[model samples]
Target chain A: MKRVKKWAAAITVFITGFIFLIPFYIMFYLSLSSPGDSIAEEWFPRALMVQNFREAWEKASMGRAMVNSLVITVGAVLLLVFCAACGGYGAARVKNKINRMIFYIMVLSMMVPGIINTVPLYIMMRRINGINTYWGMIMLLACQSLPFSVFLYESFIRTMNSSLEEAAIMDGCTRFEAFWRIVFPLLKPITATVVIMQGVGIWNNYAQSVFFLQNQNYHTIPLAISTFFRPMELIIICLPPGRQLVLRLLQWFF
Target chain B: MMAPAAVLFLVFFVLPLCQGVGISMTDWNGFSEEKNFVGFANFIRFFSDKRALHAIQVTVVFGLVSPFLLNVSGLFLALLVDSKRKSRVLLRMIIYLPSIISPLIMGYLWTLILSPRTGVLDQILQRFNPSLSFDWMGVPDKALWLIIMVNVWQFTGGPMMVYLAGLQSIPKDLYESAKIDGAGRMQAFKNITWPLLYPSAKINIFNNIIGSMAVFDIIMAITMGGPGYATESLSIYIYRQSFNGFAGYATAIALIMFLIIAVPIGITMRWMKNKEIEM
Candidate 1:
């Protein structure tokens, strides 16, 4: 009975793993196939050529898009992390009603759908001349991701002892300096989690990129990839610089 | 210190929400300077309009199904890979690989695989049974299920990781003590594991519910709410409306969706908090 159960578990895990990998395999195979050779026509490619990727990249102006995406993602992640860390620290350490209210409001904001904010945000962006600007996209994306990060940072920071910062403050360090030197460094683990989550969130974002970035010159990877629905473009869009970052994060988890 | 986040929240989040509430009552096409106030008209129309109503039904069905499916699968996978065996590490990576990529990419990939004539699945099916080509997204019901299944596939990894993290924090000594009492595996799981996992369960389930309801990228890429608005979620409908020059109407629909998600989630979170306290 025990032997049968062990085999059953192994087989189940193996089959499910295979099923999970099917789309990744198909996308990779289709990416490697030549353009004129229809992917659906044959299961395997006649020739494995990586030239299609280069063609797809040039056709989509992906170099510009990749740079734009990287800028936006990095900017958004930095702004989000800084503001969320401060707000989370305040809410976690401060015991006042206003702080608690702010924390709860931020938490409630998570339940608000992004679609609801689309029209008004567009109007506001146009009014403020924020359309097609990196700061415009970064601010909104940062705000969108802020609540979750604040929640994560708040919880993680709450678990940490307050004595370290107190001792630093007593040693002639200003409160800001104490927090900068002590509290912030201790938040490395949760900061990593925030970076990984928000990195992917900003990197792979589609609707905001398409909506906010009307100029083709300023298009992010998702926007450019969405414009052309080719298999080659799909492969290009799937592998961003953040892909390596996320893979590294998963490695750290083990 | 909180000023920046507070300012951002007011500008991007709170301000827009307030503006959306006001815009929903107007007859403002996106480009027009004239904003005619037509109070309650759009909301009433949302209830009466067939496409809007169908989108609501689709959204609700998706909300009901995908969360349950994704969480169950995630928990199962988490349990499977939680073992201390070396092979489990590879299994974790494979299971999570899809989720690490963009859902838009996954949706487009599936679109190619599920196309009636040119899809890989159809091509494979054609080899065995010549008359068995299937249009996975052509039919209304099937399209809904297909999007839901695809969403489940892409999103399960997130909750799986959450559960795995939760499981790791659980003290092994409890299980050891239970074993000393001659408690069986099933009993120990029921008495300890399930109860202790509630916190993770709450977070995972809540996240899944929100994600499934606000599902836009996958459906937009795969079906584009096609086959006559069959798989249109509220977000997709709102997207169509806004791009089609009904920005006011779209905002109105978006507000309704906001209420639909917010009220229930809030109540459930409160209820779960109470339950946690009781436990």
Candidate 2:
């Protein structure tokens, strides 16, 4: 009975895992197929050309795009963490009417769908000369990410012991200084979680990037990959699975 | 301490939202400063627009169905992993692989798979029975269904992770206690696990509601709301309308979309307030 149960569990996991990876399997299969090989015609690669990886890598400008994504992601995450952590801490500890109201408003703002803000945001970005600039994109991404991060930080901080922070404040440290020196350092775990979640989001941002970062030079990986989104175009898109894998791998490391 | 977030929320979020409401009431072409307030005219036009109404239908269907599917599947996977105990690390990673990349990329990747003759899925299905082969995204009837399934497939990892955390936090003693009292597996699960999983359920339900309802990039990448705009979500509708010189109409549509999402969210928040589900 025990043996039967073990085999059943293993097989179930195997099947689920295979289902999860079907897209990836298809991705790798097509990426290696020669240009002459038609995905419509071929079940597998007709000619295995490892050279396609290199060809697609250079063709897609993956390196420059990677750098753009990394810089933007790192900057945005740092800014979001700094601002949201403080906001969350304040919301959790201060408990004043203004702070409470602000917290509620921010939480409520999370439901305002992206499209609502896009038109005005685009106009504003152009007016402020923010289009195609790294800082502008970073600031925008950080703000798009702010409400959730603040909510997370607030809920998380509320669960922690406040007496230590209170003692720090009582010992002549200003509230800000106490939070910075004491509570901020201990936020490492939640900060890491925030960084991973928000970093993936910021790195993979497409909607705003397509609108805000339209310049060819400023395109991130996602924006770069969209070059092949044209109709009747699969081979050009599929061949660049190298960068997509890099995205998943980057996610894995985090 | 609240200064930075307060500033960001006010300037970026609150300000844009206020500007958005103002824009919804106007005739601005989204660029020219010249404008006129035409209150509720755009809103009236939405009921007349067949495509906009279709989008509301699609959005509500997608919104309602995806959360149910994701929550159920996530909990299922979480239980499977929790039962095994030793192999979860790798299993969790493998399951979560779909969610890491941008939905735009996911959409593009699906296009590669679901494309007509030259698509991977079509070729594979052709080999199997030939009759099984069909254009998945081309047909209007199947496209929205495909979008919802893809949405569920992509983000199931997030809910699964949450459920796994909730499952692990559950004390073994509860199960042991139930077993001691001669409860069957179903009874134990119903009486204990289901109630205990409320917090995780609430969070998952909330996230899935928002994520699936606001879905854009994937659908945009996959169908671009195409095959006669059959799969055009509210987000896509707003995008096309705004750029096509109906900026005021689009903002009005956006506000309607907000109300659609807000009602469910308000209900959930109230429910959360009342329950106060204890761990």
Clashes of each: 0, 1
Instruction: Sort candidate 2 into its docking category.
Output: medium
Model 1 spans with C-alpha error above 4 angstroms: A35-43, A230-254, B277-279
Q: Per-residue lDDT for A51-87 in model 1, tens only?
A: 6556666767777877898899999999999999988
DockQ of model 2 vs. true complex: 0.59
For each candidate, what is the lDDT? 0.82, 0.82
Share of reference contacts found in each model: 0.64, 0.69
TM-score of chain A of each: 0.86, 0.86
Query: Tens digit of lDDT per residue, candidate 1, span B1-279?
Result: 667788888899999889999999998998889999999999998988998999988998998799889889999899999988877888998898888777887787787678776576887788778998888688877999999999999889999998999889888999999999999999998888777888988998788878778889888888888888898899889988998989899999998998888755777688888667233
RMSD value for candidate 2: 2.8
Q: Which clashing pairs does model 2 show? A: A40-B118
| lDDT tens digits by residue: candidate 2, A235-254 | 44554443343333332333
Per-candidate RMSD, Å: 4.4, 2.8
A70: Cα error in model 2, Å: 1.6
